[model samples]
Target: MTRTRWKFARIIGIIAASILLYLLLGVKTYLYKASVFLPNAHPNEVWEYVADFSNMKYLNPTIEDFEIIEENGNYNHWQYTVQYKEHLSHWPYLPNYAKARFSIKPDESKSKFFIKSFHTTCLINDFLCLNSESEFSFTRGYSSHGVHCDEEIAYECPAIFARFCEREVKYQRDAIMLNLKRRFQ
Candidate 1:
């Protein structure tokens, strides 16, 4: 093949690879849902169980420790310290310490509770790109006999961090729902 033709072919190959990488890493989305039966408790009673931050330790398996830092009007802000072990492409192993603030609102009429949290994962020494801010919103509904929970989480980070955020949210949500069911039953 001619040298000029070879150069053109190489350029096209590079462009195609770049496009594929962007699609694989650039756009990501995640959602998780779970529901369990309460059997005997009223919806209002169940909402109260999930709304109190102090009960988080009993209801959520992912939270190592949490405390309320401020309260203003209907918004109560709290800080949570979370520990999770994760693996990265460039790192052999990584452990994360994350701090987050949660804003919660309790709706008695609907027997629903809503919480929004903003947090940043701890930084790895060599991988600064993994440190990113994430936002998560959770909605939980209680009926006379059961409860339903749904959560949405979004993170703005490089492709790697985005993928991690998606996985972590699902994991945490599932853990919390499982714990809640165990305690209530």
Candidate 2:
């Protein structure tokens, strides 16, 4: 083999090895599923709390502002601008801005509330790659009602993406419950 050809082979091998190492060790683990029980508030009240888009600033800690640019009754389509700071193990904390669309629905008789949020941010960190759009839906119910929450994140790293989805959903749910508790108290 020629010297140049051997060097090219060595370089390709090194590149492949580096990619494998990144996949194995450079990926981050994000929180995927989480839930909290709010004892006193009913689903209807929770729905009302979430329905008011402008109230997001009070509910979400990381949200700098939530404006309802447009809406139509139960189905409200609006833009959400959020600012967040994250700390990695070896890197300095980084701040990020994200924008998304939100939809909310309420079933008064059944005492159930549903929320859907779609975000445009695809990548959270260097190792966490979000290849697909982000979406989350949460259902809150009263005593006899059914409560559920689901989140979907399309990414090359499902494990890490799942964790991030879980944390995001949990934060929104908890925020609604907290607002309801405060309002009634």
Q: Which stretches of candidate 1 lie over 4 Å from their true place?
A: 42-58, 65-71, 75-93, 118-171
lDDT score, candidate 2: 0.49
lDDT of 1 by residue, 35-65 (tens): 5555544554555566566776666555555
Clashing residue pairs in candidate 1 are 38-145
Best by TM-score: 1
> Which candidate ranks first by lDDT, i.e. highest?
1
What is the C-alpha lDDT profile of model 2 across 130-158, one tens digit per residue? 32243444355445543443344432334
State the local distance difference test value for candidate 1.
Answer: 0.54
Candidate 2 residue pairs in clash (backbone atoms < 3 Å): 30-163, 31-163, 32-162, 32-163, 32-166
TM-score between candidate 1 and the true structure: 0.59
